[model samples]
Target: MTEHKPEKKVCVFCGSSFGVDPNFSKSASELGVLLSNNNYGLVYGGGTTGLMGCVAKAVASNGSYVHGIIPEALVSKERKNLDEIKKMNEELKESVENHRGATPLDDSYGKTTIVPDMHTRKRMMAQEADGFVAMPGGFGTLEEVMEITTWSQLGIHAKPIVLFNIDHFYDEFIGFLGNCVAKGFISPENGTIISVATTPEEVISKLQSYKVPEGRFNLSWKNQ
Candidate 1:
């Protein structure tokens, strides 16, 4: 008899909003489908709108499990679409009516379980996922990705942190990391903490091959 390996769950951090570009949303949906087809579960924020919702919807439609973590206060607020912000009040009213009685937007549009708060959400997702992938997002997304990267650098965790650097959104950030290496604030070798990819297919390939090294380091060198 042959034994089968369990499907690994991946934590994906991405923008709640779709932004101005259609490519971002398209890529997000593609990633969801890929994860589902590969038997991978998704761990993400709980919302029924934006890029978050798009990814969640794709996974659920493909019959995969999704785990969503969100702060309690932001649950209702986060459900509103980002583009809705630019609309006139009258236009917003008309837009809401147009989509009325449509799919009852729920966390499970992608078959998800929602958690509350940032701390709890991060902890749970970190614990549950076999790896992590970060798509383009704003400040909140950057914070989440940084936290995971820090954890990996400290040897507190051993999961891959893949960056979906769509549209060169992360180009400047990558440059800043280089500056850190040059200034002696971080070891150039620590740069291995993340893998950057321009496409969803590359992101998956990087995650599958990532391996974290053993041991943690102190910042004594920084002081010296």
Candidate 2:
């Protein structure tokens, strides 16, 4: 008997609205296609708006798996994207025949899992992903990536985390992390848990080769 290995998924954190820079959206789409071509599935906040939707659509259209975790509070806002994906998949199913073990369009182009609240949505996203990527985004994107990195620091999970520094978007944030390390708020070793990648190709490469940094503390509730 052969064993079945599960597909690997990378959770992407990005803006719900397209930023002023055209390159931001361009990078998001490129990353999505790159992820698909590399045989990695996508896990993301279920928004069809901005960079979030751009990446998700690219991945889906490229015949890759896209699992979106959305909170109920924001479902009304993001529902349109889901609908668009479904319609697009339906059209593809009608026009194309299955080849190369592709999933049937009627079956599922991708899926959206709606949770009751933000916490649940975030928890589910974290649980589902094998790695993490942060694109140019607002506060939500920042919070999501940082929380995941903090989880890595706490020994909760050692998954790879990369910051997609599109057009040097994350330069200031990277400097902030450095300042924290310099101030001793964050150890230099711990600082390496989050990596910086300026290009989508670099993002994939880093995720593939990432190693958990030294000095990670294992927390035990029993001791607490």
Candidate 3:
């Protein structure tokens, strides 16, 4: 029997609005291109604006499959970047046919699944991704990264969660984590659970070398 393994898919969490820094956007685009060229699959929010759209377009341009799962309400708004979506959809079609050795769907390549609500969208995105990366973003991006990182700390998942700290956007947050450790909020060991990288190349390399810690385990009932 022939064994088939699915390609590794990375979940990218970023802002729907572009921040003031051009470096962030450029890094996002570069990461997308690198992921595609490196044979890494992508799962992201279906927003075709800001850093989200930038990354998606880069990946699709390089002929990689990007699966975007978005909420129903935001679907139409994302339509503005239809040009990139169109290219991604086409690339997805070719990838399905040639790489996966499967029949391609009539569906467009910027493959998006419109979920009923934000909760479902995030859940589905997390479920589909084998790993995660958080680029420069606002509240939503932070929420996604923190939730997944929390899951990692709880021992519920062992997937690597990396920070795409472009332009030092996440410096304050990283410093807060240290403060948490110093104040006894988070364990010193737990502080190292999340990896940090300043560039796309560093992020990719870190993810590739990531391995689950040997002694990590879930918590037990409180002794109190």
Report lDDT per candidate: 0.71, 0.78, 0.75
Candidate 3 worst ten-residue window by lDDT:
91-100
Listed in order, each prediction's TM-score against the native is 0.78, 0.82, 0.79
Candidate 3 clashes: the total is: 2
| List of clashing residue pairs for candidate 2 | none
Q: Per-residue lDDT for 178-211 in model 3, tens only?
A: 9998999988888888899999999899789887
Give, for candidate 1, the lowest lDDT window spanning 10 residues. 89-98
Best candidate, TM-score:
2
Task: Please report the TM-score between candidate 2 and the true structure.
Answer: 0.82
The list of candidate 3 runs beyond 4 A from truth reads 1-6, 77-109, 214-216, 219-224
Question: What does the lDDT come to for candidate 1?
Answer: 0.71
Off by over 4 Å in 2: 1-6, 77-109, 220-224
Q: What local lDDT does model 3 show for residue 141?
A: 86
What would the per-residue lDDT of candidate 1 be over residues 6-53, giving only the tens digit for each residue? Answer: 298888998767788899999999998888878787887656566777
Write the candidate numbers in order of decreasing lDDT. Answer: 2, 3, 1
